[model samples]
Target: MLSIKTFKPYYVKEEGNYIRVVLAFQYFSLLMDDKVYQFVPLESREIRINRETQAIENKDAVFVFQKGKKYNRITLRDLMCVKDFQDHLSKILSPYMILTQPKEKRDEIDYVIMELEKINLLRLIDLALDEKDQIKFNLYTEKLLEIQ
Candidate 1:
C-alpha cells in the first residue's frame, strides 16, 4: 500500500505564469509497502501549477524516491490516481493556489508602499527643519536619499 507519511513543500515560488512548488527529501516522504521512501529531486524538484487555472501543469513530471540504496521513480499522473494521495495533495496545495497574487498586482502594491514611505519621510524632514533639529534633519535627508 502507498501512503503519504509527510508532504510539505520546501518552498513555493512564483514564476512568470506559474507557481513552482519545490520539494526536498527532508520535507517530503511517502510510505510504500511499509517502507518509507524519501523524495529525491533527481532532474527536477519543482512542480509547476498554472497561475490562471490553478491546476498542476506538470502531471507527467517524474519524481525519484529512495529507501536506503534502493531507488524508485513515479510520475505525478500515476500518484494522483490514488484517491487518498489526490485528496491530500489537493488540501495541501489549495492555500497556495488561492493566495497567489498576479505579478503585476504585486508590483503595483510595492510601488504604492514605496511612495507612501517617501511621503512620510518628507513630512518628518519638514518637522525636523521646523524644530531646528540638525541631527534629525540630516538623518531624514539621508533616508530620503537612500529611498530615491
Candidate 2:
C-alpha cells in the first residue's frame, strides 16, 4: 500500500536493517522521527519462537512450558486464535525506535534489540496453558502479529 502519509527521515529498524519511512507506522499519531506516522494497527499472531534459543518453537505447543526468553504464548485450540482490539499494542510499542542509537563503532547491535523489546508488552505478559485467559491471550498475540 501507499507508504506513510508523509516523508520522514530514516530510522534504524532492525540491527543493520534501516527503514526510511515516509510516515511512521505506529499505534498512534505520534510524530516518529520528527514526522507523523501511523502504526500498522494492532493484530495478533502466534509467533513460533524458542525462548531459550531465541528461535522459532518448532516442536509443539502441547509440551510443557520451557522457561526462556518467551513472549506471551498461548496454545491454539479454536478459532479464537486471532482477534483485534482497539488498544493495539502499537500504542505501547511504537516508540521503541526512539531508544535506538545510531550504530556506533564500539556498540553491538544485539544489545539494542534486547533493550528495545522492553517497550513491547507482548514481550512480557505470560499465561499458563490452563489459565483462564489463555485462549484470549493467544488470540491476542496472533492478531498483533497479523497487524504487524
Which 10-residue window in model 1 sums to the lowest lDDT?
91-100
Alpha carbon lDDT at 137, candidate 1: 97
lDDT of 1 at 122: 96
TM-score, predicted candidate 1 vs. hidden true structure: 0.60
Query: Clashes in each model (backbone N, CA, C under 3 Å)?
Result: 0, 20
Q: TM-scores for all candidates?
A: 0.60, 0.16
Q: State how far residue 76 of model 1 sits from its true place (Å).
A: 1.1
lDDT of 1 by residue, 2-24 (tens): 88888888988887777888889
Off by over 4 Å in 2: 1-101, 104-128
lDDT tens digits, residues 34-72, model 2?
A: 444343312322223222333323223321111233222
Q: Which residues of candidate 1, in runs, are more than 4 Å off?
A: 98-148
